[model samples]
Target chain A: MAYSDKVLDHYNNPRNVGSFDKSDPRVGTGMVGAPECGDVMKLQVKVNQETGIIEDAKFKTFGCGSAIASSSLATEWLRGKTVDQALEIKNTDIVNELSLPPVKIHCSVLAEDAIKAAITDYKKKQGVLTPEAVAVH
Target chain B: MPPLPRDYYGFFGFDRKLAIDSAALQKRFYELSRQWHPDRFGRKSAEEQEMALEATSILNDGYRTLKDPVKRAEYLLTQDGFPIAEQRGKDVPPELLEEVFELNMMLEEVKSGDESARPQLEQSRQHFLGLREGVDRELLREFQRHDESVEASPTSKQALQEIRGLLNRRRYIENLIRDVERALNPVTPSRPAPG
Candidate 1:
């Protein structure tokens, strides 16, 4: 399937394609994989604790171009967004932005999952209770 | 030739079970192939001839699918409502992903002309191969457990679920092994250039 020019662009010159210090308390790291395709993606975000905004985002992915582009685009959109705003970033939004075909929609979904995972990891580090954690109580 | 069973197991006239005698399956396949050879229907009516062709197609496809243990288990999983489709990230254990990510990083380093990581990759390849052997052994036991259980019983369903999880892990490790081997050998790109 032909990738959208946008996907190709991001794939060729993936933005924020690196990682943050995993041990940093302010850094939230998410590592996720798609077993069917054997794709692994690691996305990280550094939050400005006082301002409650994401100051930086990075990603490293080992998979198809669509997956690499999806996470690349995710990091681009993540910076400057508040943690809550970032949570609102949906997989469909990524799909629409990337013009991903039906078969490649899971790539965008993986990116979205990585975002939530990173945020959750950061929250856990902060000892903040997530909604799911609260619901369990 | 009342429309042969759509399912592979049904097409082969085998009971719905995971543990099958390979020798028996091969014998049955040959018998069916001869029965639906199409030449036998040379003087038959047009519809009967068509049915023979259809059965021949199904038999060939079904035999190929059922001949391999992994393929057979995958087919049974889908038949039993465990499609083994894309697993959600939550379904995968985090530590496995972490390991996969690290191995991938090492592979990239090696691909970029650094041979320093070669020894480590070789070690990892052996580790992953060992992991795959363990998964295969467990899968064998699970197949037996599944076949011994009553069809549609809770035990059968549970076994199927466990098989699905095991298959996912196996697939992950298989990919890692393939990647490590490729990195160590430095062949053509692991994936075709993306379009």
Candidate 2:
């Protein structure tokens, strides 16, 4: 199956593909995986504690091109955005942006899930109370 | 059209338990295959041939899935309408996180053609293989737990949940092993060797 041009671009030149100091109180790391596909994704975010803004974001994904592209797009959208605003970034938006086919839609869902999980971890580190139920795809 | 069996065990006419009689299952599979073989319907009408083809397809799929313990567990979960795939990251044991993280890092090194990482990758492969075997044992216990429960009762929920969790862990470990294998020997397409 051929990937969309955007998907291919992101896969070839994934942005912010690295890790942060996970021990830093300001940085939150979210590690996720899809059991069915054996894909693992780790998304990390450095947050500005006082302002609740995402100062930086990075991801490392072990999966297909679509998964790498989805998470790559996720980190790009995360930087400089407020945590609340980041939550507003939906899987559908990622899916549409990458023109992901029906089977690959779950890759976007995983991306969106990684974002939420990262934020949740950040909130926990900052000692902020968070909702018990975080979305999982 | 008659509705197909909801689970592989039912499809294969076996008892819904993990301790399946492999010899019997194999014999049954061959019998069904012969009955559904397309050649048996060669002189039949087109519609009959189509029906035979569909049945054969399902039969083959059922057999393949039922033959593997892990796949059988996954198939059962799928039949139960449990979003097994979606349960991915959420259901993994929290304690395995650190080990998984380290393994992923090693995988990266291997992927980058770092020969020095081979020993570490080999170690990780053995570790994950051991872990997967442990999970299989747990699955057997859970299977018995479920089988012993009263039929159509809610008491089986705990066993089912445990089985689901074990299956998730097993899947992750299997993937880790595959990664190690791929890195150790990168697959090259088969071609005629140059003289």
Candidate 3:
């Protein structure tokens, strides 16, 4: 299927494609995969502890073009946003921005999941108790 | 005809169990083929001929799907309300995902002309193949569990759930193996010239 120009652009020149030290207290790492398609995406965010803002974001995704573009766009949207704002980022937004076809909507969903996972990791590292963490406990 | 017997097992006159006898299934397939062959209904009413055509279609599709163990299990899963394709990443264990991600990175390296990583990629292929074999063995055991339990009972449902997880892992390993093989032999013809 032909990808939208935006997806192609991001895919050809993925932004913030790398990783952060998972062990760093200020860094949150989210690793997600789609076993159906054998796609793995790792997204990370480094937060400014005092400001509660995400100072930087990075990602490495191994999958189709849509998946790469989704994660790349996710990282771009993540930087400069506060943790709360980042949490507000939705899969639908990614889908719309990338103009992903129905079948590729899962790629956007994976990106949104990666974003939430990264924030959760950051929260846990900061000892912030979220309902999800409490539920897990 | 006759609503296509509801499912492949019923079409083949077998119980809803995973332990199918291939010989018997093959015999039944031939019987059904003869019974539904459109040619036999040439002189029948148009409606009967239409019904025969539909039955033949289902018979062919069902036989192909049920003949393979993996495909049979997947079909049963969907019939049992466990849609395999709709399962998400959370269905997979975290450790497995980590290992898959690392392997994918290595594969990318090998594909990008880093010949130094070829040996490691070969090792990874063997490791994944071993994993795939282990999964196959586990599937066989689970199939027994599924076949032994009363249909739709709690035990049967639990067995189906276990089978689904194994199938997911197996598919992931299968994809990795295919990728490794392709990367290892990028230029080799898919079918070597007759030797």
Candidate 4:
């Protein structure tokens, strides 16, 4: 199937693809997998404790082009934002941004989930979740 | 949980337990597929062909569900009780829904920003893993007791319901983690993408 231009762009040139230290206090990591498909995804966000801004983001994934594109889009959205803003970023936004098909929506959903997992971890480590955050990370 | 036909275990010709013989299961599936598969009845009458297809589909479904423990548990729970699809009316605990939503959001974040919250992602994995492990253990215990009973009990009923919810929730979280891992760690991204 011919993916939308946005998906092709991200798939062909995925961004912010790497890993980070799991022990870092400033970082929150979410590693997940789809056993049904034998796919794995890892997402990370470096939160600025003082401001709760996501100073940086990264991911390492093992699946298809849609999965790659989704993760790529997630990292691109993560940089230069408060964690709260990052939290607001939705899989629907990524799907719209990438123009992904219905079947590939899970890939987009997956990327969005990783960001939240990472942010949640960061908040959990901070020892207190702000009332505004709901601390679901 | 995946839906399985009644008497699925009987079709597979095995005792109900986590310790299923993989090789036997595969061999039986392939053989059944060869025997009952619609492809073999392509030249037959329409009624015969339809029967062949139905049989093969049932065989495939049963074997697939029995092939994996997580799936098996989920299938058993679903079989024992109500379909989770109908549980939408009830209020699920916030903790359960929260993790599922966040796991999805992180998948989007890490895709664009590499190595941003890698640590946090791992932490989430650990947390979910812990939760899943506990749930899994609980399921095993329930199943064991269920095996010993002459008939189902109220406790088993409740446990299976909870198991169904956990399994469905886990499946969602699992999908997100896979998307991130596949995107960033593709030494080989050559496989077919998910639909």
Candidate 5:
């Protein structure tokens, strides 16, 4: 399917396409693999520990155009936001923002999941378990 | 772990088979894809492009499941009135459980030993190779028996389940063997923790 103009723009010139200091206490990094496509994406967010605001977000993705667009849009949505606000940015929001087709909707969902995984990994490493992370499933 | 579509059967377009030619399956996938992929829709209307993408997606999912023998066996079990999941804590085949534990013990011993891990991994790999060959022989026998109606079958379903259980164990052993091989290879990543 022909991608939307927005999707094509992001694919052509992706933003924040790199990595950050994942080992830092205030930086959450998520590395996700799609076994279906053999694609791996790493996304990271640097948060202000005191104020819990994301100061920077970056990504390194190896996949098709939709995957790149999803990662770029996710990073754009995350910058300068509080952790709680970032958590609220759902897959549907990214999909709608990019106007992704149904076939590409999963790319958005995976990007959203990568964000949550990064945050959770940071919190786990820092040994500060938030209620969100520790709630009984 | 997501729910596979109820129409998964529609992808293969036939009742499942225990033994299939992997090459033939791949060839068929390529043929179906050539006929259905969205790239062919450049000259078609917009709606037609969408239809082509959806069809290709289904074809991809089907080929993925069938191309791997382990997954194909799991799909067969699901067809034969089994829950898709094995009970996590339940004991697998006793022989497999024993084999894994023994190999693991040997690996742990080899890890800090003076001798290189390469020799030990090679040794363990040879052992598992024998086990895989034996399992393959058994699986072939089971497949033949199922195919033959001449034998008065008293326990066909039971036999399939046993064969499925054996296949699951063989795959598990193969996975462990792969891990050991990776560890022995020169491409081993730095240890996760350093002093």
Candidate 6:
């Protein structure tokens, strides 16, 4: 299938395709997998300890072009954004940006999930209560 | 020929379970194949010939899916309205995430031509293979459990759901194994740049 120009561009030149030190208390790493397709994605966010801003983001994905593109776009959107703002990023936005076909929509979902998992990890390390935890009260 | 059953097990006249008798399935497949073989319908009416072709197609698809345990589980799961292949839900076991993370790192190293990573990749491959076998055994037991439960009962659904989760884990591990294989043996040789 012909990928959208944006998808192809991201696949060919994926931004921030690397990893950070997971042991660093400032860096939160999220690893997620789509069992259906056996696609694994790891997204990490380096947060500013005091300001709670995400200084940088990196991702590594093992799957199809759409998956690579989704996570690539995710990291680009993550950098310099606060963790709260990053959570606002949605799969639909990624899907629309990549112009992913119906079958490839799950790739965007995985990307969005990776972002949430990463942010959750970051929040957990700081011992700060997350909204979900706050919601339980 | 009457319309073949849509489900693979129904088409093959076998019970939907993980522990299928391979020999019996093979024998039944051959019998059905011969019965539906288009060549036997050479002198039949055009409509009869078309029916035979359709029946043969269904038979071929059923046999292919039913012969493999993994595919068979996936088929049963789809029939149960839990199509894992298309679902975006994160159903993997939480404990596996750590192992998957480390495995991915090793895979990256191997891809980068770090020969030192080969040993760890091999170890991971072996570990995942063992895990796959355990899943297969677990599936067999779960299949029997479901088959014994009253049809359409909550017990049956529970068993089916458990099988779906196992299959999801199996698929992820299978993918990791494939990546390890690819890294261990690089398929494409490096090509010289054009002058």
The residue pairs in collision within model 3 are: none
Model 5, position B177: C-alpha lDDT score: 69
Query: For each predicted model, how many residue pairs clash, with residues at least 3 apart or on different chains?
Result: 0, 0, 0, 76, 0, 0
Give Cα distance to truth, residue A50, candidate 1, Å.
2.6
- Regarding lDDT, does 2 or 3 come out ahead? 3
Off by over 4 Å in 5: A134-137, B1-68, B77-195
Poorly placed runs, candidate 1 (over 4 Å): A133-137, B187-195
For candidate 4, write residues A14-103 as lDDT tens digits.
899887887899988876544334445788888888887888899877677888899988998899899778889988998888888897
Report the number of the highest-TM-score candidate: 1
Off by over 4 Å in 2: A132-137, B1-13, B23-67, B80-88, B94-98, B187-195
True contacts kept of 2: 0.47
Write one digit per residue (lDDT tens) for candidate 6, span B9-66: 8888887676688899999999999998999999999999988998898898988988
lDDT of 3: 0.90
Best by DockQ: 3
lDDT for model 2, please: 0.83
Per-residue error (Å), model 4, residue B25: 14
Write candidate 5's Cα lDDT for A1-137 as tens digits. 89988889989999998777757888888765443343346789998988989999998776679888999989998998987788788889988888999977778877887788777777787788688774410
Per-candidate iRMSD = 0.9, 2.2, 0.8, 9.0, 11.3, 2.0
> Which consecutive 10 residues in model 2 chain B have the weakest lDDT in total?
B80-89
**Sort by DockQ, top down from the best:** 3, 1, 6, 2, 4, 5
Q: What is the docking quality class of candidate 3?
A: medium
- Cα distance off (Å), candidate 2, residue B129: 0.5
lDDT tens per residue, model 1, A1-137: 89999999999999999989999999999898999899999999999999879999999999999999999999999999998798889999999998999999999989988998898888889899578733321
Quote the lDDT for B17 in model 6. 70
